[model samples]
Target: MPAPQRSNPAYRAIARLVRPVMMLVTRRDWHGAEHLPRDGGFIAVANHMTNVDPLTFAHFLYDNGVAPKVLAKSSLFAVPVLGRLLRASGQIPVFRNSARAGESLVAAEAALADGECVAVFPEGTFTGDPDLWPMLAKTGVARLALTTRAPVVPIAQWGPQDLLGRYGKVPRLVPPKRITVVAGPPVDLTDLYGRPLDAVTLRTATDRIMGAVTRQLAAIRGEEPPATPWDPRRAGRA
Candidate 1:
């Protein structure tokens, strides 16, 4: 299958213009971006702290010359203008609630099999973690990586919570605040694919991947490790 391609001169131009604004406001820093493959199908697994998470991921990838096919929630495409903009930018819509969730899987599989990069938030939704730490993730990512032999790139982000505090989950027309983004080494799940998709195996693999993401988050924040399986309400304490 040929890699999916989306062309939107208008959206690309807008994204290019917005990159500077994002950089100026967030004063962001990126590390280990070289870990991202220049050409191949890989899964970009990231923590979901705020609505801007996707934008941060997209900006970094685009800046690095990789146009990722983002798996976004279908609801985000409801608005007329915003929806159009997202579609123009090559984002794939996944209907999480409907029976159509398989639709996204099909699309993602095809994209990866075609040697394209696809980004997924394993949490499926915001963790609502008071400190913006990652929560237990879903198994789709594991399934995808295992089945397709695609590399899983775990990205840890901090400081978006500050942006959340400034904007309170609402977009601010004003300038941006400080945000930090970090990319970790890609995870290889080649050994896990051949096994049966049993519950125990799936959870074990997901926990392993989440653990890596947690470590990256700790590195970025310079904080002690939050309790395993990161609980936001109790400060990730057991």
Candidate 2:
């Protein structure tokens, strides 16, 4: 099967601009690449470590086989040049807390139906966990994965947060960071995929997806994940 290609000129343009720059400062070690389907639709769900990781994650996905279309915060699409790049590159902007947030899902469904890989960061934003562990995730990822019946592939990424802090900081490039992205087999949502999209099912499926990613991280981080994943509300971190 052929690798997924981008037809959007803006995507092509960004690829020309960013790919070379990325290769210069990042060394990629990707595992379980076989889990990435060569063709068709699927949702690649990953933990949020650093905002910059998305760029490199996109690079990893594009290099392996598929081009990822992500659901990003609306604010990102309102910026000047960067916004234009995001929009022109076929990204879906999410209008939050208004009447239009639902449109992001609609756009993502359309992309998935069209055989595109839709990448979702279930943690929604950067993990508030001080240790950089993934916090409790949003359920939209489960909804999207089940609604479209697409494989919910779990991937864990490490090393990007070291290079870039949540708030803008001088990025460290010397000694070029080793960014490792590992993909585990798709989370076993088959039992829950066709079930009613009730809160229980959605939450359960979301946990499984997060669990898979955590497992991957545990293996890579050489540590044990918390017995219960960090919950912002319970921990008063919300």
Candidate 3:
């Protein structure tokens, strides 16, 4: 299911144009970018704080010598002009409720094999916890890291939440807030490589990854970490 590494013309064009605009519009800042693997495919796992977070992450990675293919919600690709643009820019559409989870994983692995960075939101939704800390994440991201042997980067985003709150859906062109994207170092879950791919291990790894994200978010937000119940264990039905 992995995508080929052939040049994505549309992505190239968009990145070429968007980087400068992003820089001019916001004082975009990044940290721990050195943690990004210089020459291979990896999974960039981040919390979904706002709609604009994806573009910010994409532009940051692209500027830092890594262009990421995003795992976007399938519905966004249904829009008219935006959908066409997203498709051209090499974004991967995922049907959240469909049985196609495995198919998405395949595409992610392919992109990693080709040395492209694939960005994923482990939480799968915008943060609803008023505090902006990471909630429990899904196991799809862990599955990708294990299967593709890709370095998993933990991204902690701030400022984007201010531009558009969780309910904003999208950012307003004349919005009052500026957005910022911060990339943390890549996390290596290679230790779990040989572990059985069962519910227990998957959930454990997922929690560990989210724990990293939570730490980063806590630092960025300058607030004490949210209480443990912020992300309680869910029944395993997958």
Error of 2 at 203 (Å): 0.3
Evaluate residue 111 in candidate 1 and report its C-alpha lDDT on the 0 to 100 scale.
Answer: 85
Residue 105's C-alpha lDDT in candidate 1? 86
- Overall lDDT per candidate, in order of appearance: 0.76, 0.84, 0.75
Tens-place lDDT per residue, model 1, 1-238, is 1112442575476576777677776766877789888677788888887777787877777767667889999988898887887787767898987889888888899988888789888888777465667777788887777778788888887766666552365655356665677888887566677898888778777877877888998888888765756554454543
For lDDT, the strongest prediction is: 2
- Please write out the lDDT profile of model 3 over residues 1-238, one tens digit for every residue: 1122433778777766776666665656578778888778888888887877887777667767776889999899999987998888778888888887567778888888988889999888876565677777788888888777788888887787666667776555453445545567766587899899899878878888887887887887777876662443442212
lDDT for predicted candidate 2 compared with the true structure: 0.84
Off by over 4 Å in 3: 1-7, 169-180, 229-238
Stretches of model 2 off by over 4 angstroms after superposition: 1-3, 236-238
Q: Comparing 1 and 2 by lDDT, which wins?
A: 2
Q: List the residue pairs that clash in candidate 1.
A: none
Error of 2 at 195 (Å): 1.9
The TM-score between candidate 3 and the true structure equals 0.86
